[model samples]
Target: MKKAIIALALLASAGIQAQDIYTPGEGEGIIYFLPKTQIVVDIIATRVDYKPGEFGLYANRYLRLNNVSTRPETHWEIKDIQVRTAGIPDSTKAYIMKLKDKSLESNIELTDQGIAKAINTTSSYKEEQPEYKLQIPQKHENAHQYMTEDILVAGSSAKMAELTAREIYNIRESKNAILRGQADTMPKDGASLKLIISQLDKQERALTESFTGVTDRTDKVFTFTVNPEDKMSDKVFARFSSRLGVLQADNLAGDPISISISNSSSLPAPVEDGKKKKKIDGVIYNIPGKGKVSVSFQGKIKWENELQITQFGYTEVLVDGLFDKKVNTRVVFNPVTGGVIKIDKD
Candidate 1:
């Protein structure tokens, strides 16, 4: 009997934890696709046109392609491509890197049982390359050979040759020193070879940008999915962005709930523990009715300050040792920083 009670208690606690983290959705869903661009190339043409999709996605946004082009380039070279949706932050956008042929260029093959898995990559080198450029200047050397008898100065005219030899020796010494050091030691991480790599990066970026307005089926595959309804800041999107292409929105229900703050927002800062603070971060339960709640308040407010609550289908419940000595609240936690904004009232 005691074991049964303990099991029941554990089940109840698990339910509450799930409720605290459950995102608002009719039925949680994820969209998956084998996104591919069909590229067309002319036999006699010198260039081929690559066309990818142009639509920016919002949660619940529906897209279907029926008659796409079907031309794959056999002789064409692949450029690593990384792109982002407008109004999305860099911290959230994933970009392609061009260090090697297989560096994070695209991620379209991560679907499981009909769900798109997210893939995340970040660019660490931005703007610093321009500040410091590495250039390896060419050094030219002319080979010279002389007999031992000719090496000794024989007359007044030989003095001019001696002076010229001295200058040549100095130049050769400097050039030889650089060559010897380079031969004995490996290249620095960001010096000569790195400069070459940097040039390749620039070219790759240019190549990617050149295809910005592609209209061909270049086999460029896949895009991310985002939930427009989730109210959490950088957090909500970041969570959805964990695996490569952000989660696809095909499985989302209802219309896109967010408009301007539309798709994503900057996450709320974490409140210090033990600091008396008021927050509204998680779903709230209406005290009057049992409806689940979401707050659209632009900013936090105190009891004396007018706050919008009841309008969003939530009835404020009073609690001890919280706001107003009678807190109108529910669980408030920041999903981005993984911290509770305030202790949920019992």
Candidate 2:
């Protein structure tokens, strides 16, 4: 008898453990929809404000059900979520809250006979409706300077819209937090610039191939020349020019470079909105043995005089022992344009 009782107790414990395992079922909350579920919600409104004592800015967004009609009301469920900002500077923190105190009410009327019949009839009804809210907080000394009003929810799978929304919110929050901490000490020069240049080189190389062949010369010196006809597009040129400007602003003693645009051919047609797209041809030259570098671009001008103005863009550079150091550099057409330009080396 004692052995039988012990065996029965052991079996009961195992049965409890088996029941603890997770399984999907109706009316089981958001966790029930962990596998093969589809949900769609539209944004209703968003509110953001600074929470001074808490050391962060708080944002609250409300979403409404968009696909509730596809599934039975009792079968709908929501799961856990994460959130983050798209391109903001600071990291944000997100929390999900369930509003249990709210309820939906409906009005219906029946005649005297219908009311008496409904009282005698027994029917099963499940109206399990719930509202959820997500709270996001961002921490930054200058959070207001970079706050955005837009929120995006990217789905994990085609069916996991609610989970995606939650995840995106958490991601944005975390990114904002990281940015808040690192924004002040972000690198202004040196390796960052080097990496940017390296990436640009790789991208340019992928777009076009460079040919190399040894020239038959008796002298020990080796020389290479890049033709301007292989220059990149105007947009690429503009991007390089902008980067150079940023470098100059950061380091005035840095290498000096100039870029100009000109179109010496036919006059361009005026745009429909009274704007004209000017076609320009420019050259970036590295002057040997000279401290000064010049960039020349020619294009048609509406000016009273010259049909083609050779706009001279000049800057002073410190090229001391640059050639001897073998500082590898490559100038390619802007990826936006297919025009090639000259690349100079000592």
Candidate 3:
């Protein structure tokens, strides 16, 4: 929890055989575990993607125009649900990708103030004026008017990971100078860094608490339905998507936020479980690949660090089927802190 010395000890007991897996500047933080969703498959073996419904990224603001309170109401299900604790920025302040497909745009319009806007269609353009007013309808042999979309809003993506990691570090750095100044007995740059640090910590803490307080961790759940012909099963699905909620957004920089989703049954068995006495283990993995990984994690503490490093908590496992040969790596993480600790892989 202090510095390199403590981390080194944790490494030794953790027993990770892979390389070091720590980010440079990210400090301690909370890692909120969102509820997991179930995906039903057709017992097939093939890559797949699915989307259940729509998702929105919104910001909250209350205003009193003419001394009258005015803030549009939100869905009762998500009234005042915290998406980004620091408040979402206007279009230019941050990267806003409303929809994934370049051709398709966000159906949910927004005002310059970050409020929802009405959706309307543009008049059909014409190269020439119509000779007469008329109406026409195209006919199809057996076509049904349904709809389709290209983006999987809820699944994990590189952009989402980058945003999450940056936000976590932002929360850390925002309070870094304050703590440093307190130790020196001189304000950071001779300014009231303590006050700033206190404010930032409060906002970060509230954002974090909001994540743990969510009532609908997983909703609109159905199944990870797959192609009827492709073999699909719990074993065959091969974890194609994952997401970890971030409490807020900040401008600070840090390493990419990475995580592996797993269940109790999926955790790896201890190396000598069947033949020898049980030993302490680390509860983290450092996976570099993006495809399916047989992730297993838990903790008993006192885990041995095979990397000859002084890391306090650690464990290792071999990840295979990530394109080709297996990769050797070890990692450890504290759920209470949003730190990945390590995501190393050979």
Candidate 4:
């Protein structure tokens, strides 16, 4: 009879233990297991906006654990956290604000699945209520914003696994000088281990960024110049000169201007002996007072393929009698098309 009673008590205890097990997406808010930990966490955020060129995320978390073992009661504490930006290549620009405690450790892990899980689980978490609002001048035309809060709870066994994986990964891939050789040499439960793990997380974040290819390309050089006075001499030159001078001072203050010039003649056929023929259509010049001068050539010539001008001209007259003049005297000719590729001021 005593043995039956003891068996019932043990079964009841096991039932309680089963109920205490933490499962991903089981509790309220955004809570998930950290690889191999018994920690249960809840995360909440509000007014989160996901937009191109503009994004904002605010989150808060709470953590706790249930003691179900007969051994010395164990307490679980959130020692650190790891947040990742996943999927979209450069979507990690949004910064975490007001980290609860600076002394708390943090890391960024880069498994392909880590980000995907976070994003997918985001919808399961509840949005947090707003505490306050501030009036600020709007900078972007269409900027969206939001706020959030969260909670996290974990168990002792799970927490141990989290620590173990972090240690192993740190020892293998971490680049921190202090963590070198110390992974195996340091006391397992000491503060040094925590510090090393924190550094490892930071290094992981940098590695993820490198792999995402988020660095902008800003080293390419592009340069071109125009001449407004070339090939202009008569009424055509006067009108164009006045228009360009006024446009530069008003509409073209910060704009790219397009210039197009083509020959108005045709080229003759090639002669016998298989030698390539040459054709001169017209000469384009940059005369300061004449604007742009286009002298047409005679005969049936292929102007597009033969006679081409190198330099164009530009002129800007100032109200104080100071003339702002620019000339494209250097011509980059394309041999295949017999055309000008680029023109610049000499």
Candidate 5:
């Protein structure tokens, strides 16, 4: 790929500006490619599924749980959408810096992908991978563990539910007694007290679910990548459904999540000189253009940001004469944006 990019750059430059351009006579030189930005969208969605209890239908009559759903159901909610940018090699912006005359200096450094990083200096680029704290969905606590002997040995679900409800009430009353300092046995420290109260609340909640039913919530992430060459509006990036959660853009069952990108570059358009005669002896790099990216769902904007997009920008030159001075010239480039980071003489 590097060889192909170098060959293409050489051919293109020769055809366009052969008179002014300079190339290494024969031996080795440093070659590098600029980078184009790739936009990444991570859509985070949460799914909540409800499972009815055995006695859910009798909840209102027995335990006064009027809100307990008798039927099982599943639903999804969009949590958030995160946007970020990454750089990839751009073959069209490849360049070669002749090193035949400069024997002592390994002056130019390029990334593994041949994107320029530092000139007359040492540097490295390491892309950091996002770390996700694993969300291992916790298994629902076994309701049987907190069940009383009466509830366990009951002949019917109704009897078991009644016993469980009474047990839940007892646990709640005990917690209240501990909080009020009226329990027979109290903890000596604040930590112990909190632990005791927490355990009681857990037991009560688990037992009460026999009548109120259970809902489990889990999170999911879907990613989409876009490489835009021009302005785009209302592009469907993904879809979402209340019943099926996140879906691909082509899925017809879900609603569309639109993405829009517009060139926001502030750089003035380069003026074309009528004369074709040109001479170039320089290191060329891009002045990355700006782009505004936004995501919309249900006609409301969810996220928006501006990022440096190399494909939208124009190339500029850094004359090779700078390094030929008596003092060494040091320069650094942002490999992602292909823009100069720093320049110094030493």
Candidate 6:
């Protein structure tokens, strides 16, 4: 879709009320929207599952494996946490740009959400959502895939376990022989020798895992969106359990994971004058306030950073007469923070 000016109307004079410039659903002019910052938290957790081997009971006797677990088990762990910011259109900050001259129409640029990105200059804003992905474990080969014909067709579980253990030892011996350069027929190169040893090690591990069991792991991401207007202390956003992994905040299955926000804005608090203050009439933009955000789990801080929060700060406007036909002005805005990036006039 075309992304720029929506509608335009010539203003009679510059003495217009500031409220008229931003009042919703009013005049026919270029309707543009300001942006608000949204905090995104991505939690990555890993789930581990262990499957007991079919011949686990005979593992200790045949392979000398000690304390091999015969029961299946499942558990979860928090691997990582990532924080990012996204911009969304703020309906309350929508405004209309009514200019006396229509010559600047061709130089305006805006995002799809009607957030002003640049005027009389090039902008690199691409209206796209963030990408998320979850990784899953791949299927692993079964012990039978690496078993010898005699071992596969063994009459009893005890015999099969012994035969498998012998095969694993054989693979290990072959790898050692190649590594020691004592094999009857050696590989032509170091790369070939490495490949042969790696295959042998893989086959040995598959055979051994049949007795010791196998643990499979997969990673999943959980996302939470936050919009902050003030300071927040120890707000529980999610939970984590060793048995269930990530859970909702209301879920009692896990322990609480919290987030804390502290406003660090340098802007003075707004004063209430007896007369009502009007919204600015000129090129309006935000002077975003700074804030520190942190995440904690299990009584320990995990991640923290400072970010620009559009809601914490006040708004300001460029001086009048900057957009006149006689002046050549260029302005670039940070849509995420609603703050001006650059301003130039010739």
For this target, which candidate reaches the highest lDDT against the unseen true structure?
6
Candidate number of the best TM-score: 6
TM-score of 1: 0.15
Instruction: Tell me the lDDT of model 4 at 89.
Output: 16
Off by over 4 Å in 6: 6-21, 102-107, 126-135, 267-280
As for lDDT, the candidate ahead, 1 or 5, is 5
TM-score of each: 0.15, 0.12, 0.15, 0.16, 0.85, 0.87
lDDT for model 5 comes to 0.75
What total of clashing residue pairs does each candidate reach?
A: 15, 37, 30, 54, 2, 1
Tens digits of per-residue lDDT for model 3, 139-171: 211101111121124254443323333443566
Residue range with the least summed lDDT across 10 consecutive positions in model 1: 37-46
Using TM-score as the yardstick, the better of models 2 and 4 is 4
Candidate 3 weakest ten by summed lDDT: 77-86
lDDT of each prediction vs. the true structure?
0.25, 0.22, 0.25, 0.23, 0.75, 0.78
Which lDDT tens digits does candidate 4 get at residues 256-335? 22332332323322236977744221111111111122211112111112122222111111111111123213333222
Off by over 4 Å in 2: 1-156, 171-293, 297-346
Task: Tell me the tens digit of each residue's lDDT in model 2 across 56-166.
Answer: 111111123222222111111112211111111100101011111121000111121111001111222222333445433332232222222331232222323333334
> Predictions ranked by lDDT, top down?
6, 5, 1, 3, 4, 2
lDDT of 6: 0.78
Per-residue lDDT, model 4, residue 292, is 20
Give candidate 5 misplaced runs (Cα > 4 Å).
1-28, 103-106, 124-136
Weakest 10 consecutive residues of candidate 4 by summed lDDT: 54-63
How would you encode candidate 5's per-residue C-alpha lDDT over 195-305 as one tens digit per residue?
999898888777777777788778888889988656799899789999999999999999999889999988865877887945676678778888899999999999999
Select the stronger candidate by TM-score from 4 and 6: 6
Per-residue error at 72 for model 4, in Å? 50
Ranking by TM-score: 6, 5, 4, 1, 3, 2
